[model samples]
Target: MPGPIWTSPAPPGNPAARRAPPAGRFRSWWNSCCKGRAEPSRHTGGIVAPERVDFYVLNQADDASRLGYACMIAAKAWRQGHRVYMQVDTPGEAEALDRMLWEYQAASFIPHARTGTPEAALSPVLIGTECAPEKWRGMLVSLTRALPEGAAECRRVADLIADSQDHRAAGRERFRAYRAMGVEPGTHEIRL
Candidate 1:
């Protein structure tokens, strides 16, 4: 499958540019997530009200490596007793990750179920192309170029950026969008 092109504010003439949710809806989502807690910001020199999001830039360029790293992160989070949501761009990617989690590491096992599955509510990890704030929480591992809906409700959001020019550019756009939304997103550069 071709990698996703991530651009925010959608470049002119690009039909795939994602339109953000309406301001009212976005504000409601943000409010519900933050619950009026003010987050401290060093750059702004004042309290900024927004949920935290993290962007991970992988050193490997292949899809397998990116998905593997995502699994690693999700496994770690699950072990830490946090519910995890692994958001992909398509159902195929979701299925691929589901298969990967079972065998990604020989000695490790991460309990996960696809969204809408009967076991998803009880599983520590839920994989899907969309977010389910009501069922999934804790950490969100986003594999898509665009920010997954309802990300603000999660305790932390991780946007994975593959080692490719297009992926990096899209990651930057996501970073900008998060910042604009008053959320400070940290970048993680993965060496492996």
Candidate 2:
């Protein structure tokens, strides 16, 4: 089991909730994690890059485009045989994503369910408001301003930045947070 990670938001004025664990302590958890994953590497990582992370820079900041791209990304990953969890900030976003995934492509559909449902465990993709569920930690596509919880345990985390001032600011904060978590995140520009 892994020690507690500050993956979610604490109510305002709760300083401890916002504070992250020390670097050495966090690294220790990653090294000793027994999640049936491959043998631990002697180096400061595993088979993949340390907490592999990627940020997608979007040209348009509109909700439609953001959800569309997220749907596409989730579909591609699912087709490639990787389970994905789409983390949204609230129940409304979760519902929006669930509906968008269904109608994203007229010729195809992406199988998915909300986090608490029975189908979520077996579905290739899951959309949820929370982020710490062990089963949904394979790959995370976060559509929230704050980084989702349990991100350190995920094999890969995909964050998005829409073309808006607020989005950019939030993206910068997450970029810095990822660095603090010992990950050198990769970046990609989405033309559409």
Candidate 3:
């Protein structure tokens, strides 16, 4: 079950065209074809394309506060003409965010739908546990502890870190992860 024997090809005008190919001259064509191809490195493909990550570390320990802040960021991004993708920890969180999007701003609401829904394709903002779709390549507001799987696609990422000790630890881990991915994350203290 070996690949085809790769006979060396000669130029049309070369007199060597009639000569037999030498031993080892039949090297695997596949290997030569793939030579110099770079592979994804240990550091998330070694930051194949560096990303701009900003960590928003809130002063409050309440989980709801983090989500609320995420709502604000998503809304702002939507208004700025950027497609926003909200990455949550669970479907429960996605639902909660969907509800908050309607009430967070009181008079106005950020139009958004869950990841798989058809409306998500047209909406400026999308919320879900899954990775952001290829088209939704704007800012990704992450509410999860670990980095979102589709983070590499987004040009900018906003990671909300709650003030609790556990949340802080998780945030630190994510910080290191982004660094490993070739991005130096910026930290901003959120007072609200």
lDDT of each candidate versus the true structure: 0.75, 0.77, 0.76
Show model 1 residue runs off by greater than 4 Å: 1-50
lDDT of 1 by residue, 104-156 (tens): 98987889999888997788789998765555655678898786776655656
Per-candidate clashes, comma-separated: 0, 1, 0
Give all TM-scores, in the order shown: 0.72, 0.75, 0.74
Best candidate, TM-score? 2
Instruction: Choose 2 or 3, whichever is better by TM-score.
Output: 2
Give every collision pair in model 3.
none
Q: What is the C-alpha RMSD of each candidate to the true structure, in Å?
A: 16.4, 13.8, 13.9
**Lowest-scoring 10 consecutive residues by lDDT in candidate 2?**
28-37
Clashing pairs in 1: none
| Candidate 1 structure lDDT | 0.75
Winner on lDDT between 1 and 2 is: 2
State the weakest 10-residue window (summed lDDT) of model 3: 28-37
